[model samples]
Target: MSFQQNLQSKLQGHLSQIDGRFANVKLLDQFETNTKLPRSYAVIGFVGFYLLLTFLNIGGIGQLLSNIAGFVIPGYLSLKALNTATKDDDEDLLIYWVVFAVLNIVEFWSKTILYWVPFYWLIKTGFLLYLSLPQFGGAKFIYYSFLKPVTDKHLFHESKPASKVN
Candidate 1:
């Protein structure tokens, strides 16, 4: 097993990781047990509420919730990552932030038009969750496949001295 999976298994042996990125959903799982709730129902119902909000596009609240999901979890994780002595955790999350920065830059300019896109908040929230989740490696895949090539060619080149005209 990889270091992260191993570490997580050891640390969160009893908790479920469904509600959000940072916290465990064991409490919800435990509550469901006595109530005899279907596992899938609980999962779907929990997520569906947020998706319903996005689907309805209730003013800006749906978008706000989606954005909160994107930021609050990672912001907390970044702090936890900062306090840890292990270099591995820092390196893992660093890639996520890099991808987020690139996406945010693009979003900044494109957001005015993005509202016209169908289910924009739902799509954005799903993408952000996929990027932030370590098990998925969405961030790493995009970084290596797309961003790395461009940055390696342009950003890295800028750090080198220019050729002399003489």
Candidate 2:
């Protein structure tokens, strides 16, 4: 198994022995769901971090540009989510897009110590929860976009039927 899967397996084993094993499982499941969901905070975090890096300008236009970029990546990711024929894909993508768009709007216009500090704390805390969760659903989006396509192609190649000899 891959390093991450091995680590997750070991961690799950250890966690299952803890006092509140079931609770931990439920929580991890929730987290995994969230991570897999399209346009979720993981994607937002990546895009937001990128925008912050790219923009050094302390102006309205810079803020607008960043917000636009943030919207595009997550939105695109959400769109790509439709490729998954799984049952939960639609709901997950919906949740992600809605939350992501709303939060991105707030983050975009936030300025000064008053808005920035508390909002930063709030978003940061949410992000921390996201990161701390054992299984984040948002991870699925990454896996699907980057890994699943290749894996699927390998697993299910296009085939042709053979003619019957009558």
Question: What's the TM-score of every candidate structure?
Answer: 0.69, 0.32
lDDT of 1 by residue, 1-166 (tens): 9999999896554334443432355766675677785344566676789788876778877678777777887888889999999888687688888998888889888887476888877888888899887778888899999999998998777442464432
* Clash count list over all predictions: 0, 13
Global lDDT of each candidate:
0.77, 0.51
Model 2 lowest lDDT segment of ten: 125-134
What would the per-residue lDDT of candidate 2 be over residues 40-87, giving only the tens digit for each residue? 334346656755643443443444454454455556656666676775
RMSD of 1: 8.4
The deviation in Å at residue 153 for candidate 2 is 44
Off by over 4 Å in 2: 1-55, 101-166
